[model samples]
Target: MKLRTFPQGVFLPHHKEDTAHLAIVRVPPPSRVVLPLSQHTGAPLKPLVQKGDTVKRGQKIADVDAFVAAPLHAPVSGKVAGIEDWAHPTLGRFQAIVIENDGSSEEFRYDPLPEDIESLEPESLRLFVREGGFVGLGGAAFPTHVKLSPPPDKPIDAFILNGAECEPYLTCDHRVMLERAEDMLLGLRIMVRACGAQRAYIGIEDNKKDCITHLTPLVRDLPFPTEVIPLKTKYPQGSEKHLILAILSREVPPGGLPLDVGVVVNNVQTAAALGRMAKEGIPLVERVITLSGDCLKKRGNFEVPLGMLLEDLVALCDGFTTPPRKVVMGGPMTGITQATLAVPVIKGTSGFLFFAQNVGKPEHSCIRCGRCVLHCPMRLLPYLLGRLAEEHLFEEAETNRVLDCVECGSCAYVCPAGIALVHLIKLAKFEVMRRRKRGGK
Candidate 1:
């Protein structure tokens, strides 16, 4: 297939061979798990259970009064050790519920599955999803219910399932597409009903021909209109904006969203979870995580609980061949580096990558090269944003569309001078957004 052209993007070494072929493995729960109070994008849930309290598997441990946030459940039967501050892999330090495992892999008692799945209403189905604690497993961690509940004024026309696992070194979604085809399709039906859309499309990158081959046949007899488009394999092709453009040829304008174009995008895993939740009433307790890197002895995907630590997960993957110099949660491009291995994996963690000391350092300066601008998918001036940000000209940076940068690090990757353009632009964008929010007050 001929590759589709986007405004700006860079081709980096995928490094996905380390684990892409491996089937998903289940990691044994660690001795203790640190469940963060806040995992989704909205407000943090309040702890419902305190220290010394025993919680059963699938029991609600933390919940928020807000509708925008999903409730959190215990992944295992355990006693709450205490509530304390712990290192969050993405959000830094935050209050977390530490639970010591009781060693019983007990399943929670819930209603048995009904033989007929078509009896439920769309609103009831959405409530079930919210109650089940599901979030976007594709790493944005937005509450799924909120996304389903688009405003009445904005009528949705098409629902897009993002099967584009474009990130390097992570293939959990690919595996899900290949292995969980039925569940994904059923979930799509539910999502179509929830969003009140007439048709749905599954956008998969051409790199995974196997997935396309597997899913195309299964979706043939579906009630709703379903089409699977083989997208051009490119870095950040899985991003919401780019995916919209690739499949539908619609541009999500500056400071706009996929919804603005009457489209709703959901990850395959999220849909699979919804399918399981609607029928089985199971909550989002565990998910598939890709654990791979150069320094690790074992590299593959693992089905792990939300609160497990990196050390325990790495140990299960046969431990590291050499002591890891740095550990990052998720794919290398968009994933954040952890300050310590002790940080627990939250709902958004798609992969845990370990690197040795040989990895290259960040670039020192920009050579005024236009490579960043040329490769940026957003088509914003990353080099100029970096300069404006560095000089503390926050207003100029905003005017130059710093906030529009997706932080995909395309500029940093293409920079011959090794300038940390992405990092500087991100800092400036943050400051600008903060100032704007403050000024509104």
Candidate 2:
């Protein structure tokens, strides 16, 4: 088979050596977990419990009436300490339910499902996913059910399972694929069945040689047409659009989605979570997180409960090798720099990265470098977009297709002058969307 890849992406030095070989260790549930009501991409969830209300593990503590919303479940059997504004991993600040663990692991009984899930209807499978509160564990945090059930007119013909941990220093997905191959496949099978697609492809980067070796034989006997694809290891190869382009040679139009192109893409962990949810009746309460970088003493992949504080993770990792100048959530290129350690990990927390002060190049003025334009996966002129954004010309940036930018940081990575092209483009995109939402030009 010819190994395929998308064009114009930069080669990333995957800083996954530390945790790639380490077995995933189960993180003991914290004494108290802070469950954010807005862990996902849609509308915030409403608190379902009041102060002094006792809750059990796997009990739905918060929910919303919105179709796009994904509910939150209790990670441990505990009492509702309070519902108050708390620091969130991505949202900065949001209301969260504080639960004090009482040492009892009592769980609410899960409703039994049909013995043979393959025989169930797609709508039935979708309902199960929605009730289980599944979301994209690959960092976007979009509700999984919404993605699973696309509009009827836009029929899905293919399903792509993303196993490319292309982001630097993140290996949680890699570890998940190796350890939970069966579970991942189980989820992938359901996802394939749910999306009304008969063919599914699982894409893993070439760097994860062991994963390819482990998964190749499993698909041989699959009931549906499932193919294991070995992708070129490159930055942003895991992005839905790029993955679609590489695997199927199809282009998802600008300002569109994988669904628009007759394809449904998902993370490897997301599939695993779905498999676990359907099989074990567990909702999205915890996830695997990769903690690795030059500034950490202990580094490995861990299965941590949602809403555990970053400070707790730091402590669990034995603190940093030196006082980290920066701590980021996710990968170094696309991850956001954390402002405070008080924030709790949410459903989308993929990895925690720490870096010493001396690590990267300092920013400088753009020196007419066209590298950003040349390497952009979307083929948008990032340098021009950055210039327009710097001038606060949001309309101009949008006209130049700034909204098409995937924000992969490839331009910034390759820029000889160290221009913060991605940052400026993000600012422009934010302003553009804000204006568009308000009916402004």
lDDT of each: 0.84, 0.88
Estimate, for each residue in 291-337, the C-alpha lDDT of model 1 and write its tens digit. 88888998888888889988888778778898888888888888898
Q: Model 1: what TM-score?
A: 0.95
Candidate 2 off by > 4 Å = 358-362
Q: Compose the digit string of candidate 2's lDDT tens values, residues 1-441.
A: 467899998987787888899999999888888988998899999998999999988999898999998988998898999998998877778899999989897987467555466788989888888888888999999998899988989999999999988998899999999999887888887888889987999999999989998999998777788889999998899999999999999999989999999999999999888788777888878899999888899999999988788898889998987988888888888887888888888889998888886355777787776888778999988889988999899998888999999999999889987788899999999999999999977
For candidate 2, the TM-score is: 0.98
TM-score of each: 0.95, 0.98
Candidate 2 residue pairs that clash = none
Minimal lDDT window, size 10, model 1: 109-118
Top candidate (lDDT): 2
- Model 2 lDDT on a 0 to 1 scale: 0.88
